[model samples]
Target: MTMAEKATDQAQRNTEIVLTAMRELFAEKDITALDRYWAEPYVQHSPQMASGLDTLRAVVPDLEGFSWEPKRIAAQGDLVFTHSIVHGWAPNPVVIVDIFRLDDGRIVEHWDVIQDLISAEATVDGNPMV
Candidate 1:
């Protein structure tokens, strides 16, 4: 394969890793995904989460009625970003931009921007949060 093709393939793999990890952790509430996809010394930048995968293993199963709907994803080089809507962790649905950094196909770092999904009526421009 050409260099461009190889890059594209790697990007796709990275994106899939992010998506599958999310599905396993959030949708399935399976901690095994952490071992499968997360690297040791995982760096987390989300204010809500501590800087390691162990915290996730402790927290996910207790989340009542949690649901994740991934709206979009993109990947470049070693980074993947996912835009998703999550429910049950907060009073209102949250829109999140989750960025993952991977090395050798294992996620090593994460950062996220999360905001409560505002109602369409609350928006001055009438734009949806999704």
Candidate 2:
């Protein structure tokens, strides 16, 4: 494989690692993977979450009714973006686009854009959000 191909393969693997950990952490409520996959100076742009890996670990289990499942994931270099469905987080399901910056195979920074999945009646366009 070419050098670019190798880099792409590595990036894909990194994204896969993050997605797998997210599934385990969110769906299974397993915080054990946090320290292993995330760094101490975790920068969180989402107003709902705090910084630090410890904070995430502490907060994960308390999200009793919420389940975040990744619908699509893509990565380039050290950054990975995932579109996910967040069920039970609100009265209606929410679609979230989460972006993460990874270094040395661990997550160092994060940001997200979340939107409530509006009802069919409320939506103007006849298209699904997620």
List candidate 1 stretches off by more than 4 Å.
none
Candidate 2 lDDT over residue span 1-130, tens digit each: 9989988988988898788778777787878888678886899888987888877877777776888888888899999999988987667789999999998888899999989877666778867776
Q: Name the weakest run of 10 consecutive residues (lDDT summed) in model 1.
A: 48-57
Winning model by TM-score: 1
lDDT of 1 by residue, 36-101 (tens): 999988999988889888888898889998998889888999999888889987888999888999
Candidate 2 weakest lDDT stretch, 10 residues:
119-128
Q: Supply the TM-score for candidate 1.
A: 0.94
What's the count of clashing pairs in each model shown?
A: 0, 0
Q: lDDT value for candidate 1?
A: 0.90
lDDT of 2 at 104: 86
Clash pairs of candidate 1?
none
